[model samples]
Target: MTPYAIATQYAVTLLPETDINSHFYEITVDYRGHGLWAITRHRECMNHDGDWDWEPIPSERTDEWIAAHRFDLDTALRLAKEAAPHVTVNGITAVEALARSARREAQS
Candidate 1:
């Protein structure tokens, strides 16, 4: 993300992937007020390094991860829309929000 791109004020809370840590699936909206580039990781605990360092989740593991946690991203998105009807996304689907942000960022 560009330095100009700031994080939106709100965060989308998702189901915890394990009883590991207090904050899991810490998804945040892009500066444009849409969740793109959301962080999806199991923050069960700090690593041996004593920090919560990690890598991005691979696409292949998405289904398995969700299954293990019984968490569905689509359902989370739907709930967000339902709870916050005032939030606007230019008619873009929440799933596509991040991709759209990435495209816009790439063009700059």
Candidate 2:
């Protein structure tokens, strides 16, 4: 049997309108089963440990379950770019090519 995995790609940045107290923004694309994918938004905050925390920004479209839906990688890429233009892998605007951006941030 082949391996079962849910691959996730993330693009995160500080919100421009962010208050000095709160800085947050995240865009992630997850590969769900079949031809489905999930584009999720997340915000940063403090956790119980007084540490950085991330929570999903829920929307009606993404909140509930559905039998069937259609989405494409291009849409996901656009959303991520809109969320953070600087969220690029080697200056590339396409989010699909930016899965390694997080690693770059981590390294730098």
Candidate 3:
């Protein structure tokens, strides 16, 4: 399988005014064709506080948004890594695990 097949795809959405502060921005990650693997929402902030404070958004909402919106995978990944450095490590680990799993499945 191509690397992209197992790699996580992410997208961000900025909401308009009137919503809860915690749900100002939506972030999503998709794994293969298994639909959304993760989703989170962040409060709008001008600067990073260096704290893990994102709230987990519902999977149904994430799936609906992802289906409706289109995202540039490269840019999204870059931005995600920039916004949360820890995501880089998570992304790499996820990719490696997926690749290994695929290889094992193929061997079987």
Candidate 4:
């Protein structure tokens, strides 16, 4: 499996104004049917006075959002590395190990 990541930008809207802050991103790679999924959702602390408190954004519509943003897996991984390189890692080894184990099981 290829490396994957998710990035999010926060836009705060007051009753009469708007503010944008640092973009938050995360990367995760699948391995042996398990992997780490780290997210830094809404890391911006630029909440202005009288602005609504930060609220969790729904990800159920992520497919639509990804389409709207015109982001592909490569772009996503690149963005993730840019935002947080330490979070991304290789998973090919784990996948290979899993596959070998599966093949052995099948033969058994």
Which candidate tops lDDT?
Answer: 2
lDDT of 1 by residue, 1-108 (tens): 656754343355432233132122244322212232222224321222222334324454454443333223354344343433222345644334444545666798
Ranking by TM-score: 2, 3, 4, 1
Alpha carbon lDDT at 72, candidate 2:
59
lDDT of 1: 0.35
lDDT of each: 0.35, 0.42, 0.38, 0.30
C-alpha RMSD by candidate, in order? 17.8, 12.8, 15.9, 19.3
Alpha carbon lDDT of residue 43, candidate 3? Answer: 31
| TM of each candidate vs. truth | 0.21, 0.35, 0.25, 0.23
The candidate with the higher lDDT, 1 or 2, is 2
Candidate 2 lDDT over residue span 25-108, tens digit each? 345555545655445444332222323334444343343232222235565555544556443334554343334445554687
Candidate 4 global CA lDDT score: 0.30
Candidate 2 Cα errors over 4 Å, as ranges: 1-6, 12-23, 43-70, 85-108
Residue 74, model 1: lDDT of 52
**Deviation from native of the Cα of residue 85 in model 2, angstroms:** 5.7
lDDT of 3 at 55: 33
Q: Score candidate 2 by lDDT.
A: 0.42
